[model samples]
Target: MSDPTRFIPVPTPETAHFWEGARAGELRLQRCADCRKAYFPPRAFCPECGSREVRVERASGRARLYSYVINHLPAPGFTAPYAIAVVELEEGPRMMSNILDCPQTPEALVLDMPLEVTFERLSDEISLPQFRPAKGRAA
Candidate 1:
C-alpha cells in the first residue's frame, strides 16, 4: 500500500475547504441546500438529490468507532501497534481515520465505541484527522 495519509484525502478543488477545515482542527461536512443532506469528503454536487448548491458545515467532531484493526506491523512512517479505524461521524459519514490516544488492542478498540476527532499536523497545508475514545467511558 502507498503512504496511508497521502492516499487518504484524495482531494479535489471542491474538497479544499473541507481539508482546510480539518487542518484547522475543525470538522466540516458538506450540506446540500436542496435536500439538506450532509455529506463527507466534500464534493461539487450533493450526493443526495444531485443538487449543485452545497455549503460547508462545521461538525461537532463526535463520532463512533464503526470498525477498526490494530496493525502490529505497519508501512513505513507508521509506528507499529496503531489502531486504524473507520469512524462514523455524527454527521452520518463514515471516514477512514486512525484511532489515536487509546490503547491499540482489540478489547480497547471495539465497534460502536464513542470517539472524537483530533488533528495531527502532517504538513503546513495538510493534517490528518484521528479519533480517540469519547469521554465518560468507564474505567
Candidate 2:
C-alpha cells in the first residue's frame, strides 16, 4: 500500500526559502524592498511593483478563512471529505491549503474565521503549511 503522505513538493530556486522555512516550522514569504508589499508562491520579482529587489521574511502565521470547499472525491494522496481552503494571510497575501484539525463542514468551517499555520511533514525535505482554527475559535 502506498502512503498518502508520500506526496512531496519539489522546490525551485525561487521557492527554496519557503520550503526550508516550513521544515523549520516557520511561514516564509517574500516582501518587495521598494513597495514593501508581501507576497507568496515565490517569484523572482515583486508582483505588485515588478521590482527585482525582494527579500524573504517570516510571517506571523495568522490567517483568515477566505474561501473553501469540502472535497469528497478520492485522490492519490488525499482522503475524501477534506477541506481545501483559500486563506488570507495576515501579511495580506492569500494561499491555498488544506484546513486541518477541524471537521470538513460548513458549520465547523466558518468563513472569515481566524486560522493559524501548522506544518505537516510530508517527506524528508517537504513540510506543507496547513491551517487550523485559531485558538478560542469554534471548530
Candidate 3:
C-alpha cells in the first residue's frame, strides 16, 4: 500500500490559492463573475459559462453531511474505521473530507448532519481541510 503520509498534494498554479487558503485556515472556492456559479477543483475558467472572470472567495465553513463510508481496512496514516465523507458546503459545493472529532459509526454519522470545517496542518506548507460535527450536535 502506498504511504498515506506521503500523499501530499502538489498544488498547481490554478489550485495554488486554494491550498494556500487551507494552510491559512480558510476555505476558498472559485466563483464565476459572469454566471455567479461557485465550483470546486479550481480551474482557470468557470466550468459553467467558460468565463475567465473567476474570483477566489472564502467559504462559510459550514456544511451538511451528504454521504460517507466507514473504512475498516488499515491504510497508511489512517486508523481503522475512519469516516470518509462527502460534505455539502453551504455555498452549494460538495467536498470529500474526513469527519474528525467523532466516532466513525453509522449511529454517530447521520445524513444531513451539520458540520463545520477545521484545518489539520500536515506540514509547514500543507494543511488539510477536515470536517467535524458542528457545535451543539449530540456527542
Two-way lDDT contest, 1 vs 3, winner: 3
RMSD of each: 3.4, 1.8, 2.6
Query: After superposition, which runs of candidate 2 have C-alpha atoms over 4 Å from their true positions?
Result: 1-6
- For residues 1-139, write the lDDT of model 2, one tens digit per residue: 3355456779999889899999999999999999999998898999999999999999999999999999988867787888889999999999999999898889999999999999988877888899999988847
Measured against the true structure, the TM-scores of the candidates, in listed sequence, are 0.87, 0.94, 0.94
Candidate 1 residue lDDT tens string, 1-139: 2444554545679888887898789988888999988887778999879989988889999999898778887666687888777999998889988887777788888889888888877666678777888878611
State model 2's lDDT.
Answer: 0.91
Candidate 3: the clashing residue pairs are none
Residue-wise C-alpha lDDT for candidate 3, range 1-139, written one tens digit per residue: 3345646788999999999999999999999999999999899999889999999999999999999999999877888889889999999989999999998899999999999999987777789899999999945
Ranking by lDDT: 2, 3, 1
- The runs of at least 3 residues in candidate 3 whose Cα sits more than 4 Å from the true structure, single-residue gaps closed, are 1-6
In candidate 2, the residue pairs with backbone N, CA or C atoms under 3 Å apart (3 or more residues apart, or in different chains) clash, namely none
